[model samples]
Target: MAKVEKVKKKIADIFDLPHDTVLGLPRVTLIGSHQLYIENHTGINLYEKNQIRVGVHKGEIQIDGEDLQLRTVYSDDIFIEGKIFNIFLKEQV
Candidate 1:
């Protein structure tokens, strides 16, 4: 990690704060197989009925599913509804 990230991690550990909140990392939440919520997203890179790619701090989040629909989108978050099959992170190069 970088020096600043190391410091932020230390602060988060000391204060018992969520690492995602402290370090600007992505926070992903899922509800069953029908809904997904992502926080700290920078933007949406791709949107399709079967896939979605969301930009984050140092990478992107890829969601693969069926009948995917973006239910809501905000500056830093997104809500998706679908029959989700897979989710993964792709680091930037």
Candidate 2:
């Protein structure tokens, strides 16, 4: 891990803060099987009717679905609605 990551981990552990929240990692939430919320995201990598990829601090988040729509976007959060079929985390390698 990089020195900054190590420091962030230590700080997160000591303060009982969620690593994702403290270290600017991505936090993904699913609502039923049709919606998603992502926080602390960097930007959208890809957008399509069937898939969406979002960049984050150390990796990316991908959502597979049908009829995907970017419902809302904000500085720190994104909402997507569709027939969400799968979600996965991809690390930088």
Candidate 3:
């Protein structure tokens, strides 16, 4: 991490803050393979019935499942509903 980021992370750790909230990292929530919520996403890269790709700060999120559908999308968050099977994070090169 950069110096500023390291300092910010140290501060966050010292203060017991959530890393995702303090470091602008993505937060993904899955519920019983039927619902998904992603926070701090940059945008949706791909959307299909079986897969979805979401852009984040330093990487992308890939979701694989059946009957995938986006329930809601906002500037920084997304909600999905379907039978989720797998989720992956791919770092940018």
Candidate 1 has its poorest 10 consecutive residues by lDDT at 1-10
State the lDDT of candidate 2 residue by residue for 11-43, as single tens digits: 999999999877888888999998899999999
TM-score of each prediction: 0.93, 0.94, 0.93
Strongest candidate by lDDT? 1
Q: What is the lDDT of candidate 2?
A: 0.93
* Total clashing pairs for each candidate: 0, 0, 0
Residues 1-93 of candidate 1: C-alpha lDDT, one tens digit per residue: 789999999999999999998999999999999999999999999999999999999999999999999999999899999999999999988
RMSD of each: 1.0, 0.9, 1.0
Stretches of model 3 off by over 4 angstroms after superposition: none
Clashing pairs in 2: none
Residue pairs with backbone overlap in model 3: none
User: Candidate 2: where is the Cα deviation over 4 Å?
Assistant: none
Evaluate model 1: give its TM-score: 0.93
Runs in model 1 lying further than 4 Å from the true structure: none
